[model samples]
Target: MTEVRCPLCKTVPEHGRKWDYGERTTVQCAVCGFYTITGTAVSIAERQNISHKLSAYTRDNTERGVDVPEINSNNLSQLQTSLPDYGVGDKQLLYMRALERRSKFPGSLVQVTPGIDYPLAWASGEEEFLYLLRDLLSRRLVAVPEGGTKALREDVSFETLITPAGWEYLEKHRAVSAISDQVFVAMSFSPNLQAAWEDAIRPAIVESGYKPYRIDDEPHVDRIDSKIIAEIRNSGFLVADVTEQRPGVYFEAGFALGLGLKVFWCVRSDDLEHVHFDTRQYNHIVWETEADLKEKLFYFVTSVAGKRTAT
Candidate 1:
């Protein structure tokens, strides 16, 4: 196997391999947040610089008797046309960009004031911003007080230190730059809840011009974790219902949060009290019937996610 390295940090990411998309050969390094675009349109100097660096690194390591794998030179021209589109979620993107902008000083940690004037809050509405913040905190991407990890409702100042996983995931998912068109729906597939998802949740997502996806819809495989991660990796946002209080649904929602994906939580009135204590701090839509879900979900998408209203 060829070993590709991040040009900026020289780290080899697991997903660092370049894939072809039409006229471009792109590489996203989750380790260093480096997204590379190369092809006929690339400048000769840039190409030469990368090639020279790789060659020099390889030669130096080889002379030192280090077992270094070389990047496959032959694969440069081979294009993988069937590669899936992997993009960063909008809310995740906003939070990351804000972090980058806010942490511009000469330090690994920074204190950010959360409010309308904040960078993250500026790009996103209040509700969405709070949800994204909770997601980041839950994922441990940013450090916060042990008890302060609950969903932020007020404008409070908090200290944040970026974690290694956060940096790599942000880079790998292209979270700071890419905009995705995928929405993941996480809910129990019980017979009674089928109508709610099809009529309310999925349709609301469709109206936002993003494709809605569910785990059960994916082909079942042995490793369910891998499939769930892959689908989240390819999605821009998530919607989860904790009505059933299923462990799998909670896991899915947590995974998405760790990845900094926007998640909308909802539950049936009777089931609301059954929701996990940790997640109870966040605001959840309490709906009685499918029609109520549809109306509320539409409003949620339009107001928080900024769905396009038809002119």
Candidate 2:
């Protein structure tokens, strides 16, 4: 056992180890008693450095007859692809370019300088220079031998340049960042009031200062495994319609309540009797017409936003 600095905990703490194959691996987190494969860019860089240092440390200890063994390296190449872009500017574009250009040779090596031609391709935009450098240095989770790629292309081009995953990522990034920056009061909402709830109601919810990002307008959001649940949990509030007792929407509303978020429950007048018992604790607002709905919804959202801001 050895004391290690857990990135999440930010302290040198107790750790355990196990032997897998011929390699020795350290426990992830002893205190938390759990393991998580995910990491922030900085954390990955730190762990990579730790892994390298530990390998060397093991070598030195082995020579001293301390019975130290090598740590099996985790493949971080896929994680290198791209997490969500939280930083501002074209960092993501530059990163995607780097990933697409990055090549792996024998011995599970990372080649940064091989046929990439990153520099030449990025020549049109010099601003990306800083973004590229920052990620390269900070997110150096794996060794990228510059000599392997040979150097970045001055004009290596891309096709379409706007992948569906890219667009979905951008939208999610904006929504999540907006919530963080207090740009808009982020709230979960739904307008699905009838058989047409999927159509008419959802957009209206979005238009009411609430982003229905969970319903991902673009069909591409699922591929990247975008953190939709995280976004919903971090929202300013939650609102839902129960006209048809939509199972999915009802679940979302319930989930939000469990998270302790203030909720606004609305339903169509026709199905008022069918409203479930738990949700019926609070009387659901019923709008008779589109004009009535708009006015009521506008006021409800506006009031909720006001209460949130005041607090």
Candidate 3:
């Protein structure tokens, strides 16, 4: 039989499974802990065609298989017979990274610090992220500090450390690693272009599922070059706006390209001729307005850097 694959991680379900209802089909993948429900056809005639349009919306008609609640031990038991076979999905990879950082500390512990560590481990605040944390607790892969309970809730803040079982699991089952989804914006921070960068470019990058960072966004006192290099090194890709023919943007793009990082070259339509001759051969996103820039950049990043998340 053909292996049933997960839509998220592209891993086959260990336990061959399927659940079919007349109007809906719910499928759970044991490999990546992915569960999704899709529309189903009731009869042979109905199965021949099915289409949903915006006009079909009704306040009384509730959506099914869409809400992801905070998953606890009880929830896990209902979903599967056992813990997932491997740590391959986004949450598992993040938890592994947080634990790895904790292991480097004097004591094997990670504090629940927002923006620094927590954001890395958990993907901000959402039911899905809380569910992942709870899943880890249920699996005995991690535990909180002395006074705290093994189960963690969304509101709680405490130090956590990976258990022995977690380490063993990591050694055996970890195959995919998380890539830094930071997209460094390299451009001339001119007063005139501030609105365009902030409103258009930055928001577009964020919508494309990557954190956008610029030198001005940081309040550090470090040397400018050092900060640029460090950010570039940590970033999965760079978006360099070469408008106005800024030397710094070119330098940053060159450094990033030399380091084998993907660079999305962009320019204002009027400034196209001003781009340096050496880099002119590269594909550039030329835009006339902010709306155009936002739309085009989002498409470019999604197409070029979409697979970075799977790494």
Candidate 4:
């Protein structure tokens, strides 16, 4: 191991290390965490000036306790394209969540170094990170000890703690029924797709230990649109199949995403070309047949959402 500047953030972290293996370089960076980058990916990132976004992407994944990622040529384009564009409010909320995760207990001080940990909230750089931190402090969502701000201003490590209000804010914004046994299905109700629903989508959710609910399958006195919203809120996650290019399905999926609920995208092989340009960047499960959809959906539910616990 040798000291070197992080290929993603271009920062020479005091504790960072690098290892070379032929065409790839594995780096352990204070800002971006552990990731390996191929030579081609390095060039692309630099050329596109997306190194900051890539750093944040890697850091966010690392903070979630996932395996170290390899930013290679094959997936770099998709990875960069799929990166979420968070709004200012969302960025503030994300920063608070990061602080919450780092805190071992209530009121536990978290050591934050703007120069080293700016990617924790997807901030473009230290200046943006400090701006967000100051906003949190002004709102009384976080507290810094005396002189801590001075250290922070100097681009050094400063200890700050999440306030009680911050915890409440997170709780209010948390996704509903994250562990519910219900999985919502948003897809076209065409008779031709009945087999796909019955043999594929429904069976996949059931086999994964979750109850599948399609809004049209059950009768309700409420308006259909209102009912759909209610059911989606109660669901643990949603499976959106855009095989028919239905506008309603897209709306429902977008609504779920706005609520921070996971929405797995899927499309029939024949209809893949019709998927909207806006959502095309998502990694959709393209299926040629009902059986293939079932197998793939089942695996995705178990691996990404986790197999539901038995009652």
Model 1, position 92, has a per-residue lDDT of 60
lDDT of 1 at 196: 88
What are the root-mean-square deviations of the candidates from the true structure over C-alphas? Answer: 14.9, 17.4, 19.0, 14.8
Q: Which stretches of candidate 3 lie over 4 Å from their true place?
A: 1-178, 307-311
> Which 10 consecutive residues of model 1 have the lowest summed lDDT?
74-83
Computed on alpha carbons, the lDDT of every model, listed in order, comes to: 0.60, 0.42, 0.59, 0.83
Better-scoring candidate (TM-score), 1 or 4: 4
Ranking by TM-score: 4, 1, 3, 2
The full ranking of all candidates by lDDT, starting with the best, is 4, 1, 3, 2
- Which scores better on lDDT, 2 or 4? 4
Clash list (residue pairs), candidate 4: none
Q: How far is candidate 1 from the true structure (C-alpha RMSD, Å)?
A: 14.9
Candidate 1 lDDT, 1-311, residue by residue in tens? 46765443344756666654454333444322333444442344245444322322233233334443223332222211111322224556546655765575523666655543222332223454566667777787766645545534546756676666777766765531245567778899898899988888888878876678887874553356655765775677788998888898889889878766778899998898899999998789899988898888878866776774443
Misplaced by over 4 Å in model 1 are 1-178, 220-222, 309-311
**RMSD value for candidate 4:** 14.8
lDDT of 2 by residue, 26-104 (tens): 4334222222223343255466544222222222233223432212234343322222223433444434433433423
Question: Top TM-score: which candidate number?
Answer: 4
lDDT of 4: 0.83
Any idea what lDDT model 1 has?
0.60
Candidate 1 vs candidate 2: the TM-score winner is 1
Clashes in predicted model 1: 2
Badly placed stretches (over 4 Å) of model 2 are 2-10, 15-34, 38-210, 220-228, 307-311
Give the CA lDDT, 0 to 100, for residue 177 in model 2: 27
